[model samples]
Target: MDTIASLFSFITTPVSWIIVQFHKLYGAIFGPDTGWAWGLSIVSLVVVIRICLIPLFVKQIKSMRNMQALQPKMKAIQERYKNDRQRQSEEMMKLYKDTGTNPLSSCLPILAQSPFFFALYHVLSKIASGDTIGVLNQELVNSAREAHIFGAPIAAKFMDSEEKVAALSASLTDVRVVTAIMIVLMSASQFYTQRQLMQKNVDLTVKTPYMQQQKMLMYIFPLIFAVTGINFPVGVLVYWLTTNVWTMGQQMYVINQNPTPGSKAQDNYLQRLLKSVSSHGEVRGRRRRSVVQAIVAKGADRNDNERKFFAGLAKAGFAAQADGTVIKSDTVTADAEAGSAARRQQPKRQSKAQRQSGGTHQTGEAKPSLEKQQDTPPKPAGKSSPATPRQAKSGQRKGSQRPKHPSSKK
Candidate 1:
């Protein structure tokens, strides 16, 4: 036990030094007397450690994706070697080696975090007893021992609640209550983050050994944390809770942007992208349809108006020929002498229903009708017409105005 303690102490020395440096930095900012400074220092230390482990977290994500990709082959190996356990293990190992994937890589982040967790636990526990460990002097340890996060000392534990209360001359109920709350938060955060990964990011259809292990851990790790959190110091709980929060946020980002191929998160991400694209396409299609409908309706209205104008002209004793030419009422009477020739030259006019319903006729007749109406000769200098009022006014202005010679300007 003594040899083990010495080895553990040696392993935890760097963690102690880091905490000491952070405590000094936070103490300078928040004042040495404030207990929350040391508590914040512990949290900052956790941030630094998690930041350093980002590459490992990325590796873990890649490994998980690789594992999901390999699920089919792993299942095949298992089915082929159901009666040969040794052979199955060998095949699985060979598969992992060939794929350059480590079944344990997903656990690397957690495994790496464990020693730091224990080290922080050790440092906090030793400092609480006023021990000079690593770079932490007696003064700093005393200040750390006195540190409180929400009235619970950084070194306080649920298991040692009574001892802490008595030692600080504080209320036993307050310490216990604070300690219980921290444990609950620590355990719950860890549980929630781990459960989120298992439920969302993992593909559940494959029954490989790795997937089975994940399934077991989905329940086991949380249970372990819930049971073990009672004995953890408040500072250690702070570190864990902070780390779990970081993990949850990081995992959520990964699940959204780079989900595992066969996972629910990936499916959801794909569905969202496809939905957005389809919705945009539908909107553009509707817009195009609406534009076409409006243009067709406008053209129909214009055709109807032109037909009414020409019919009015025919009723008032003028005639429009199929060649899009209009003959005056006086000329129509003169042309009556060649009625047989006129009838032979004129094309048959279809009924109003046919003219209105025939899209091609309406489109073909519109431009020609407009051109003939524009080319119609001015009225025989007698009556004013409502449609040509602007032209009549312009003609009167032209008759009244005379240009002066440039010599008059001098």
Candidate 2:
């Protein structure tokens, strides 16, 4: 630990300088030698560092999502070159390169913050040893040593001996108890952050090694923190705990706002969107508009959650447009439904006899009555009437009937 801290010695002066500045601001309210003064100084330092690392954290999130999306292609490459380890590695690197992804991007924030963490540890260790380092002169060092957080001196550790703890005007039991509680809180916060990420934000439809790796880390990270926390000074433990809590809150906000597609978070988000749009008759915010626009752009490619969102909108008598706006469509849908119903109606079924009779009843016209037909004049006898050509042809023999006619007359 000492060697690692020494490696970051270059940053100790700046870190101590920032801490002193924060201490000056806090020391006015809480005595100069109070735990609140030094403890909050460390916390302020963490906040500053984290604020600067926000860009890196965002990149890490993007990188992680990209990696998750590439799992299928990665798995195929692995299987294709399973017998050739070198070729498999080559292909994996090529894929990452082409995708503009860095596997190490997820570690960027941590790696960026490591120097300040170790530098603070070195600063606290120096105070515990009654030595002055960085901008922490002998006076500030003595003040820091006298600061006790929850009855444990700021520079004390869980593993510190009774004599060393007594040297800082604290009991071994107090230091151990405070550090143990802090370590547990730190580990729990870390575990919850990762667990929520895995449970609520991950694309559950895809089963990939990336998910398995994340699950492994979810357990592994907390265990690592629990093991290494004892060696951390009280002030360092406070730093870690504050940072863990900050990380948890930040992740919670991201999961709630812009969750991965096909995740539980997205489902919940879309449901809420459906309710809001139905109630307000519009997408309320720019962020929500962008979400709707992206979904609309996906068209048929939308995931289950997005499809359900569209269905809910239509059910509520709303239609989503290409511009991410909603409009009332109740009348249009109603007219379409009416037309379909009209088309679906069939004529009444007819019996075989009625169908064979030429279906005059289906024509919807009245037939003449029997009394009216009898009242009509019978023209055939009166006009015999002129034997029409058709009648003459019917009465005459087809051919050669003269001889037969003569015999009959005789």
- lDDT, candidates in the order shown: 0.71, 0.89
Residue 342 in candidate 1, Cα distance off native in Å: 50
Give the best candidate by lDDT. Answer: 2
lDDT of 1 by residue, 239-294 (tens): 88888788888888888866665577766754553344334432124433342233
Q: What's model 1's lDDT at 140?
A: 79
What TM-score would every model get versus the actual structure?
Answer: 0.64, 0.82
Where is model 2 more than 4 Å wrong at Cα?
Answer: 75-90, 335-410
Lowest lDDT sum, 10 consecutive residues, model 2, at 383-392
- State candidate 2's TM-score: 0.82
What does the lDDT come to for candidate 1? 0.71
Residue 220, candidate 1: C-alpha displacement in angstroms: 1.3
Per candidate, the number of residue pairs that clash is 0, 0
